[model samples]
Target: MADEKIAKLVKRRSCMKSKLTVFGNYLHTLESCNELSSLQLLDLETRFNRFGSLYDDFDKLQCDIEMLSEEPDDEGEEREQFENQYYKLVAAARRLLGARPHQSSQLPDESVASCGDGRSGGFKSNCVRLPKINLPSFHGHYQNWLEFRDTYLSLIHLRSDIDNINKLHYLRASLKGSALLIIDNLDFKAENYEAAWNLLCSRYDNKRLLVNNHVHALFNVEHIKHESCSAIRHLIDVTNKNLRALSTLDQPTQYWDTLIIHMMAEKLDSVTHREWEEHRNTLNNPPSLEIFITFLSNKADLLETLQENKSKTKIHNKNSLDTIKNHYNQPTSTKYTQNTYLQYNTNKKHNNTYKKSLTCPMCNQNHFLFSCEAFRSLSIEERRQKAKDAKVCLNCLRPGHIETRCNLVPCKYCKKKHSTLLHMHEAETTVQPSLPVSNLDSFSSSTDVLDTTTPPIVLLSTALVRVVDSKGNVHTARVLLDNGSTANFVSEFLCES
Candidate 1:
């Protein structure tokens, strides 16, 4: 395992270092070449940093071809150099940007129109960077691959504002006539290819229709539905599709690791079958790795010998542990519980005194420290003590008194006590009977005779209102007002209003 890990690290390093070198060479070529314009240089550098150095050679060669094509009657020497540079650039592009085509369909026509409007930004515009193309000329940006990709997409959209159609035409013309456009990292959106492909297909008769292919179009998807490789159908011939995409590199590593771990665990299980209690009790301390491994190897040999012994036992009953002592050390049962621990014997008479004083009701474990159990799942003594402290009243089943003196019945007013009592005013038993109506003559005209005078009518008019309670029920009642009361009892509704 250690060797394998080392090998993997070394291989990863080698791949990265080689990538850096390839990019370094591409950068050198860009710097040494004198004929290229600075504006074009800036553009190439921007693209190089956005993608990777792998695309630099191809891009440079494309530049060289354009320069040569403009020369109507170029010198033989210059023409040869141009031809050589052109092929080199195409080869580099092919190497860096393999031919993985997009799989997803273009955005719907309505979506495209909406996005074309400034309001609904294009998918490319949403991105801040395009993933670096594998153009080895820009090695530094490779460290931040995702960021480079985001920035690249943003730049592409920004350039669309200047001369979108013309840029598209140039890219298409390059692909069709002289330049092989290698767009690597095909995992990007299909819209990117759609734009590039539209340009190429427009100039269909152009013999050098530069290829747009990937080594293998990856679908590293969160969900299978996002794998919209359907767009590839438009470009690739359906009958000969296998030629377009092929899996390279390797099968995923996780499957092998999982399989190895499971196999090791199964082997260990078969080789560690001693009775759990006996095995646990026998261990005075944690076994060293050497001791453990030796025990394992020995168990394996024993199991093999026991298999033979078992056949013999069918003919003659002689396969007991004692009978096979010389020939085998067969594993016993495999069950093991964490509570299995060693115990010491003490005199019953002395232990009895300790037991009476230390009986624990919670777990019914040992009576003293010396005789204590070692069950980890069971709470420690301190935790159990805290729990006992926090225990509820046994009779009331509330957090206070013991069963004998719980005092859980209703009070003198017949008000039942509760665990929580924010609405204690609603306690039914606390209500009192009304007083006798002896003072009514002071306020009323007469008990039997009717008084005709509208005499000093108090004219107390109050409002009744419906109130919504905490549980969302509406209740209605007339609120009273009295001048003689010590304090005003304002209804909650009136106060709120």
Candidate 2:
């Protein structure tokens, strides 16, 4: 019986060590797993719950310590005190476990070491922590997604430590299996985006790694800057030449121009080639991919009716407004199909599944998206109520208060509301009526204005004339305009007289 008791104690201690070993190991390995998707981390955690015993052992130890404290004997008193202190530790251990559950599947092969020593603020080789991301696929993915992704990828690739690299890769592989890290901010200035792309693409000697990372570049279809257009064209040309370069990227590697045109129709529903021409020609501006796609897609819908006219395959493939989207996402049988239509479908039905990639804040679905009708109505109604609650301006229709707080002032001449008196009274008609005749006596309309040809000769007196140089030096001379001699003379005052 004594041997059995000791063996049980030994076994519990070993279990405690193993659990701590597993938990600590995970935290250490996962610290660098920023590149992995949330789903992948969850999968790892599901597996770790099977072998980690830190929590249970801590609980058992605490119970034993508490039971000893209940005894009144002197020997039990010391044991009880130790047990009480140990119970506090057990409580702490339980709390920690509750907060960070086992998130690793198989302890990442023990080959990958944990990050930093716990003393140095880094956990020991065995320290591991489970990850927790509530909205894994599509949360807070505004314009900075690409910048974040590239920065993360760079950190992983540049890491010199092999163990760190392995941990990173394992985490990344798990993430890629579950999440599509769609880059949102690719619409930045072309130079900046290109710079980021160059950095990410630099380490790409192998093509498969690039695709596995799911590097998707999102670019705006419309840009007014000439330099930006030129850069885009150049990028599109490069993509054309190296289609393989984009084979692995999550976004379609089609020419940017083509993609822009497609996305333009998708985002705007009432566009036409003629309208596109007007925007391109008049504004020297291209429509955004979203807007262009929306318009073209609409046009395609109209053209489908005029089918006596032979339609291009691109036109025929345009999705109808009322078409069922159920099968629209299934992976195509071949790469050609995938390339032609860059969409995929899954069987799983998540409540807010549409929120998986691009989410609609209104209904929170993956398909209808944030711009969908259901969400748009909700947004509009909410905005209207908010404006009503805040007492929006009646005239300007702006939010955040009434017209009393408006900076607008009444214009004196036009009797219209303006921001300032200076803006109102600076009118030409106001200037004409306000001028004093005395102020005009010495100032000739012609002389008051600048004459670049020659500095105006200032008649100091009837005989003396002066001119100022560019350096503001005044040169005065005596001159006579004499009718008697029929000559003009430049001389000293005495000679002139």
Candidate 3:
């Protein structure tokens, strides 16, 4: 009798479970609908009322099965499964009917929805505490779908507290380009969220294509052209990312050490590769992938450290150019007296001290012999003797450089490069005593004496000529023309001018 009752109750439970699945399907169809028709609403209400009644019936069946069934464990699990499906369908139907349960609001400090393991009773907390959501974006790239999907599922899709319409909003916000076009025409309503989501998932959820793309990326990582920290870091990062992605695909990566090492080694620039080879040879055992990766990481660190130190060295030990510029950039009053004196002397022909090399021969003063009044008072013979005694340049009468290299103005006394005080004046020629005039007459008569009968002299006033020198300096010069004289002479005043 007990077995018979148990069998009958078990059969009823199975029928109820089947009925619940049909209702679940109906609710799902309703949930997917963008708008409910009047008839659909009527049917939904009627079904919910009936399903609402089944809750009690299901409770009663659980109690009866627990009491009558011999195998409590199996029946208990089946009963729980049926109850879970029953709750979801009921909750969904009621929600669609605009009758969400408010029992959750009654627990002020209620335990959080235990969805940490990714399985939940589809629990939603009133005023749910959410983490700071930083949404990920997509642009219809196969390479990006996996990351976007995983992140969106965690941050938005799996969040039960957000409604389908809001989740749809997040989805739309995150999408662009062809990815967005997949669902762009859909209406922004709760019913359309699932359809839009499904379209996106269906298009981008191709695992075979993803695997091929990631694998291609693994082999196609950009080659390192130089041994730099950033480039090495990029190479390491790209390889690790692709390898991790391959590992996620359940690819045989554990045995890929030698193959990956060979491929990655070929990608390294010559210097880095040579260093890596040296490191590899130093190891007694054939290095594993971890060891190889560690070598690259350490290399990158050392390179980065060296680059930083080089930059610091440049910053600390500045060049002399700026210092020299600053030194010259100062105003005359601010500079040392010697610099000012040199600059001032460049503009004017005369200098106060002339130079350190200049020293008067007679008094040993810091002036040229020509510039000294006491030296100027001496005769040319005395000045020449003084200059010879001092071993100075008799031309400029200055020390240290010869007459050929002298830079002073020419002597005003003679139009020569030597100092005026050292210039030698010429003596006027005598009448040759007229060859004792009578003898000259006899000699001139013998040679038919062509005007060797010296012409009678006449005193002529000094003639002045306006002369312009090569330096553009114009001078009023006294010109004396004498047929008897073989040379022309200019006065000291004209030479100085």
Candidate 4:
């Protein structure tokens, strides 16, 4: 790898100093002979073109020498001299050739766009610095080589003004993984740039490898499980990109339209596949790749349109409902409020009359059997007998129904089809017959021992709380408030829901 950096640093000055002497000789000949024959002009242009090929060996050899580590004392003068001759050589060729100029690296920086205003030779007024174009990166992937090659050639390698050092900097920066390692051992000298660049190109620029990579990519296109606008677009984009790459590889993808379509269609959702089949039947000629892609694009657009309209309809309905609710919920006029008050009182009076008519079967009290003090005072057996005699629900003590047909909840304690007050407690435990002292150990071995090491019983506070569900229906549920608990919890029924 070259010991390169991305800054505009001038390194390996001694190499250029040695090359300057040779470049100066050419300049001397051009300037010394003002007029030259066709042969002489040809020689000058040919030499200029040759030097521009960037095949110099001196930069590599000279940079490795310890003596050339620092530039010569007259490095400034030498560089200035080189720059002057560089432009002079270009001018001399152009002046002699009259109309045709021999191109070398690039034309003397004249044709290159500058960030400065011509008059000031500085940055132009009102200029906005645009973000630099990010170089395409490569990581030894055969599929990514062509893109990186084209981009690097256009931006760095082919540019004449950027020195070999800067080109090496850019090449190194753009590479990663195995690609970077190939050129990573080279020194950061101007001459090593070409060698590093060549190593990367030779390794990655394999036509056969690139073809295989893209072919595999095409075969591995993701399968869409369900039809949606974005899913269809993704399927279409991936198919086209891979096919385009394969076409560039001379795979005859154009002639393989039917085969390609069949392969790609299998990756589509069932609905889209059926649609493509039905649509292709209407075509007069055999279905082509372009036609298939166009069909998918159109379907994607239709799905998008449908989704947008659906969203708009839902929004409109929601707004209309909100507007109607607002109008109804607005404050009523005084007369309307008076009428509402009278209606509420009338409903209250009607409810009181209904309750007054519920005469208790026991003691003829003006209350339901369950609410009556006399009825509650009865023992469980008596209550059961009275409910049976009255033909009322044993679970709710309501008239005209049996406990089996009643919809009321069962007893909270015993979970039986009867009111909790009427549930008979289990018979008091009876002591087991005293085991013989000799058989105590045998008896203990036959029975499972109680787990004395069980977790301590925590005393948690609870309250009957009313909570509204997703449907806005209020439910009365008991909630435990335990400060020591790390998380809030709900019943299994709520969690599943």
User: TM-score for all predictions?
Assistant: 0.16, 0.20, 0.42, 0.43
Question: Best by lDDT, which number?
Answer: 3
Write the residue-wise lDDT of candidate 3 on 208-227 in tens digits.
88789887887888788887
Worst 10 residues of 3 by lDDT: 101-110
lDDT of 1 by residue, 1-497 (tens): 64565455445534544554565577556556555554544444344444344445434544444344434354345435534654454444332322112112211111222112243322222223323332112222212222333343443424434254443333333232132343332224434655554443353322122112221111111221211123222112221231222111132322333342222223233224332224535878754333443444554466566767777887565445346553444343211111121111223333464445554334455442222343222333443343345453323323323444444453322344422111122223332332124433332332123212112332333445697767777777454443323344433443343
The Cα RMSD in angstroms, rounded to one decimal, for candidate 3 relative to the true structure is 27.1
Name the runs in model 3 displaced over 4 angstroms.
1-132, 319-328, 331-497
Per-residue lDDT, model 3, residue 486, is 40
Cα lDDT tens digits for candidate 2, 76-161: 55445544544454443333333332322223334333333323432233345545322122132322333445444444434333
* C-alpha lDDT values of all predictions: 0.36, 0.40, 0.71, 0.67
What's the number of clashes in each of the models? 37, 50, 1, 8
- Single out the weakest 10-residue window by summed lDDT for candidate 2: 419-428
Candidate order, lDDT descending? 3, 4, 2, 1
- Candidate 2's error at 168, in angstroms? 10
- What local lDDT score does residue 41 receive in model 2, on the 0 to 100 scale? 48
Please give me the total number of clashing residue pairs in predicted model 3: 1
